[model samples]
Target: MTNENNPIDFGAFTEPKKRPEPVSAPEESKKEKGRGERQEWVSRQPAAEPVAPQKATEGQISIKGPDHIIERFKQLCKDDRRVYYDMLEILMDKFEGK
Candidate 1:
């Protein structure tokens, strides 16, 4: 009998589990694919290139609250656009300057 609090010895199981062989890489394409051709096949391109970095405005304040706070804020706006705008208005006024 083993102690309930003692860790189990997995050493008794020495047999290694056999794994399936991995698939080999696909053979290289004989034909060359141009960038334009790839783009045409893609239903949608990824998001637009990120905006160019701008120097932070002088005295600009940035604050980050917990995920719960953000989640709650989002929940407060549950399917309502006005609630989101109102919350932004209050937040901007309260913390944008501090």
Candidate 2:
């Protein structure tokens, strides 16, 4: 109801300005929170599928017949028998050193 020209001063009733409180060190707040965050992230991950006891392909070789067997045997012999001998020699040398 006061006149616009009078413009009442309510500053006297207002609260005084407050200085801000200092922030605590980041580590004090973050350590506990970080563990919880990690636990949550781990829980959200998908669970791995359980392997079947009797696997469909267990003991089943795709290639069959005597020709395939002969070919496989020849391949195994040709692959790296020399490498196996070299590895054995290295192991023996190490054992002798020990």
Candidate 3:
């Protein structure tokens, strides 16, 4: 028989408390908030045209290869086109026995 005077504690099996939602500020337009006066409104200019690559000299010749080879060459160059061109020149010089 349970004692009628003693109360049973059910704290361990209680549900987790829910956190209160954060209150958000009201969104206001820049014009209405007088922010437009404080900030400068600069109009965006048109993008400049891309310059064409310079023509290769009389001694230089352009070679077209497979896309994969070109991509690998670009990767090997590591952001410097001179490295790739220099390597090609050295290879050509060695092959020509110069």
Candidate 4:
């Protein structure tokens, strides 16, 4: 840009170099347009079976106890192929006679 205010030309405050336009691939090479648009052809592979959603637990808790007891609890959970929280939930239900 031509400088009008200052007699000195520092090449600052000038418009940046323009970037070249990106080249787009052929339409046939592009994937299905978008999620919203419906396709004319059916997919060859079978769709995956939908799984049931698990229950959401919003409550958060923190408990401090003896280290030995905690280690024993973790061992028991590993033996039964259960998570610490899942076993805790089961224990809670058993106590409530659910």
lDDT string for model 3 (1-98, tens) is 23567565555466889999997644454445665543456768657877889997656567799999988777767755567668777768999999
Model 1, 1-98: lDDT tens digits are 24678677766668888999997643343223553332245557557777888885644345589999888888867746556667677778889784
**What is the TM-score of each predicted model, taking all chains together?**
0.23, 0.20, 0.28, 0.41
Q: Candidate 2's C-alpha lDDT?
A: 0.61
The runs of at least 3 residues in candidate 3 whose Cα sits more than 4 Å from the true structure, single-residue gaps closed, are 1-58, 79-82, 93-98
lDDT of 2 by residue, 5-95 (tens): 8677665466878989997766646567675432244476558876768855524235457998666655655675544345446658999
Alpha carbon lDDT at 95, candidate 3: 100
The parts of candidate 4 lying over 4 Å away from their true place are: 1-59
Model 4 over residues 1-98: C-alpha lDDT tens digits? Answer: 34687667666557888999999876554545656454457788659877879988678788799999989999989999998889999999999999
Question: Whose TM-score is higher: candidate 3's or candidate 4's?
Answer: 4
lDDT of each: 0.65, 0.61, 0.70, 0.81
Considering only N, C-alpha and C atoms within 3 Å, which residue pairs clash in candidate 4?
none
* C-alpha RMSD (angstroms) for model 4: 10.0
Flag clash pairs in model 3: none
User: How large is the C-alpha RMSD of every model relative to the true structure?
Assistant: 14.8, 20.6, 12.3, 10.0
Candidate 1 off by > 4 Å: 1-63, 90-98
Candidate ranking under lDDT, highest first, comes to 4, 3, 1, 2
Q: Which candidate is the best by lDDT?
A: 4
